[model samples]
Target chain A: MYLRGVKELSLTRSEEDHIKAIHTLTRRDGRAATNAISERLSTKASSVTDMLKKLAEKRLLKHEPYYGAKLTLKGEAVALQLVRRHRLWETFLVDRLGFGWDEVHEVAEQMEHVASEKLVDKLEAYLGHPHFDPHGDPIPDKHGRIRQRKTKSLDSCGPGESVRIVAVSETTDGLLRLLDSKGLRIGTTLVVQEVHAFDGSMDVKPKSGSAFSLSKDVSDHLQVEPS
Target chain B: MYLRGVKELSLTRSEEDHIKAIHTLTRRDGRAATNAISERLSTKASSVTDMLKKLAEKRLLKHEPYYGAKLTLKGEAVALQLVRRHRLWETFLVDRLGFGWDEVHEVAEQMEHVASEKLVDKLEAYLGHPHFDPHGDPIPDKHGRIRQRKTKSLDSCGPGESVRIVAVSETTDGLLRLLDSKGLRIGTTLVVQEVHAFDGSMDVKPKSGSAFSLSKDVSDHLQVEPS
Candidate 1:
């Protein structure tokens, strides 16, 4: 299906939020539950139900009663466009504007809603068309094509396996701060020294820095490719 | 009075639109009338009255029954911030991203509503803290201070006078296009050759180009400084 013009799509901010939330949820869990969407958006589940109904009426998604919501092709396209905008703005904020990678998310959230294709295209050019954002998440191209790399979570790596951080699956401020504190970042090569069976904490040595221990919670969120 | 933090002075998009509209109208007409604001925002006059009342309750502006609205100090501060954001985005679009000056206004309009003080400050730094926008209108500083310039409309210039185009009073797409068609732009130096008193049209010669005639409608909008 062809991507509709932003003007023709004309989704409200709340509708867009729902579309993105559903897209994220479905990608991670195979289906978007009403409760998950509500929790993600900090909105009441009833309000989210109403919004899903409205979006389904617009043919953006199919909301199956028990199975939850699934994005139609059109809905997926809109979500991709939002992701492109969000990641591109994030890149601009951190790369061009000197914003810390940790601080660009909230500002990029607002910038992403500016629905002008020309603006995005111009910005993409100005930024030299970065394939990945500062957080290491792949930025979708204009055609919604994302560059894929085979990787697994840091927690999945066996001891003595060398890996480079490719992406952080969860971008929460707390997690980013933790990564920053440990000098762990995208492209940081490390060898898994040991996995403690006791509590799932892993000791890893960086290519340049000393060894450090990371909890399972943090390792599970760090996507890494074999070095 | 100190400028309020953007979080403390959060305004809805509609409220921000009304404030900018009133700021523009009052600057040109001494007072912002309900009908004028309605026309400017393309909203009903009754709705304008309701919004005016809400803004009055919020201490942003004073709405008189027949006289119109006047901004309080707090309201003026908000308006200046918006102006700062709008102009900075315009400068970025034109100077950095290579958008035509005529095409930047609508996109900048959308961008100006992304209210992050740090984003604005960083953007100002990224754009070299431009003192004037592409249109030659002074960009307000972080403290709501504007760099003032002494200029008069081109229509007010007498024949035999040399001047430089400083700003365009009206920034409508049509006027900008008209100026573009005639190769007229901010900083273009011209000499008034003859003023046709009959139709208020004047013949002007650019510093390095052939002489051309400009209608009073056009000349009146072209602010010029003595060259």
Candidate 2:
């Protein structure tokens, strides 16, 4: 894996972002519609359509009438690089800079497009080869390989089931705050003790902290892997 | 004093850069011409002209015909924020991420425009409130005050005078290689023992290592304050 390997392509901010957004939306559904992407990005449908045409012309995506689009390999490469830079910067900002987990995404988003492979590796080494970013997002390896998760929400686990919380959402700084208030954090072996359907909450006992209840909102934002 | 305070500006990459470049040039020379800026950045003179008009329209720069330009108070504030971000990132990269002194500049140049006041403070805290970056560049205080220098170049000193090498050119990685070969680094003390005239060279003794000869070209690129 060549970390400072030749960049496959240089992309404009808007274009690179559009590709990333499309990849995210298509990850589960296998394709993303113009309308969905437009709504997701808060951009108008017409602008989305225009971008689709431009991206299709650039061979970054496949476009066919009303069928929506998918990322070509070239597009995926750029998207992964963007994701790599973003997560790496996020990890650096939080773990090394003493920034709280919730406050890193906005700045990391802007830093993702920075064109330095060496910076990323040095940062990865500095952070001790962290597999996940501050928010629990998996950082791609030097070759842009992200480990597919064999995990689910921590709150959904059965009582006495051992699991490790792997990630959280950067957008949910408030939710992270809520988790903090409840004494839940990554690597804090979560053992689900109770589930309440009335409010869809869970009582979780961390490795050392006292047992606590997490609202459904908090549960949904956390990712956990069975140990 | 408030490192966690959020910033409110939404300047683009180029615009934020304009504010900072103007701040540096204005502070150094009291005035900066568009063409002069073009040369400093190695961008087209026409591009500088276009950006000058845009920055002026934003009330960031006080531009005059051929008379050179200056930053308004508003512009200075923006520039200080960027400088804070730049030097802080440089320190974070070199001190925390294992990036070498010669490697942080290009990365920091791109990172300086990231719009995050809180991030900078967190970084300063993470780095234990360092007063300087790897290149010996002063890290501005939270209040935008840069520490003044009390050292100068070893080459500028007369025979048998002692001095310390502070910072070097952001553009000279080769000079870094040369300096490293001589066991010289930031904070390393050296005494000018002799001056060579054929190539404007000089001889100096290092703090720990034996004496070595250095070229004038190398000395010119070293940005020392005094010792």
Candidate 3:
């Protein structure tokens, strides 16, 4: 009964993707420009504008053209549901289905759109109420409560600093595969050996592997806690 | 690698629904009229015509006005994929997610559209490659192979006949709930005490329960094997 009372909001898969992209893009500033949304979703700015207008009319978000857009409380709730579904399915794919951490994201992306309150709650129970997803991101509970952790992107670590990989933010397959290839995962300890100033890449040494240089794009997606 | 080599076919939710409906309608004769497809989907015939044309162009089906639409080989493959996903998810919901047989269909309906071949293959394995779903429908394998059973509708049993429930078809919530109230499920044993020829309703007694009259609608969905 945990997922009870959440109506099956009939939003297209594209709409849900748009809402999630907006939420992530505006996470820091609390608003995201149409162009930023377009960039995140890999769509055109004009299409983003049209979708924003439609979403605003649906009262899921507030769109102010020439400026940016932010989720209304209703939109935030829906986004939380999407997030909860995504993380729960990710956990199931890895923990139960025996999928490698690097291979779960794309499948979970499709699974997350299956909107059933009962299904989500049942899966949560089946997974014994996991607090975090396989990617190390917090899995929101039924009430949209997320466990907060003091973690920063690996790019923020200075030379000689040792930290534990707590989460991976942008979980694209390439980044995950890169982390896999480097023997880095959630809880993997690594020390920053050097910082390349020209491209902002870092030479990091994992506890069990030789030191390697990771580009800014890869390092920026990695979140870590001081070890 | 089980689900490898299957391209993620891009089809909208509405398009998939239309294709599934047509697949069911044309299943008997390998052809279904547009009006029949529209009626089954509860949509207008003109709209069905438009969709049929689109599906034909996509090579999912062959449509001719005033004639019936028949699924092309490609269309049958896609429809079988949908069926495979539906039955597999139904098994997961009931057998693993702890959902009742009656409560899983709607959720599985949403889940069946998740077009991830890897997820489907993983789920099939996770469920130990279940042969039949909770409602007694044969779950299609990775190659769209279904297990056939020799079962007949409960309405087909004559008076004084004994039968065991094998499967339930047309699993509407109302019908399943009705069966649940009557303490009937897969493998439940029952005896047909009397059959009303006028209406085809049967008065049957479960192995443990007293006799009850089931309307033709209810009996039609109940598949039974001779006991």
- Candidate 1's C-alpha lDDT? 0.92
Tens-digit lDDT track of model 1 for A164-226? 998998799989988998899889999999999999999999999899899999999999999
Better candidate number, 1 or 3, judged by DockQ? 1
Evaluate all candidate structures by whole-model CA lDDT and list the values in order.
0.92, 0.77, 0.85
lDDT of 1 by residue, B1-227 (tens): 33665448778999999999999998998889899999999999999999999999999998888789899988988998999999999999999999999999999999999988889998999888899999999999888889999999999999899999999987999999999999999999999999998999999999998999999999999999999
Q: Which residue runs does candidate 2 get wrong by more than 4 Å?
A: A1-6, A154-164, A167-178, A187-222, A225-227, B1-7, B27-30, B169-171, B196-200, B207-212, B221-227
Summed backbone clashes in each candidate are 0, 7, 0
Two-way DockQ contest, 1 vs 2, winner: 1
Query: Any runs in candidate 1 off by more than 4 Å, and if so which?
Result: A1-7, B5-7
Score residue B92 of candidate 1 by CA lDDT: 96
Could you tell which candidate, 1 or 2, scores higher by TM-score?
1
- Residue-level error in angstroms, candidate 1, position A19: 0.2
- What's candidate 1's i-RMS value? 0.6
Taking the true A–B contacts (Cα pairs closer than 8 Å), what share appears in each candidate?
0.91, 0.96, 0.87
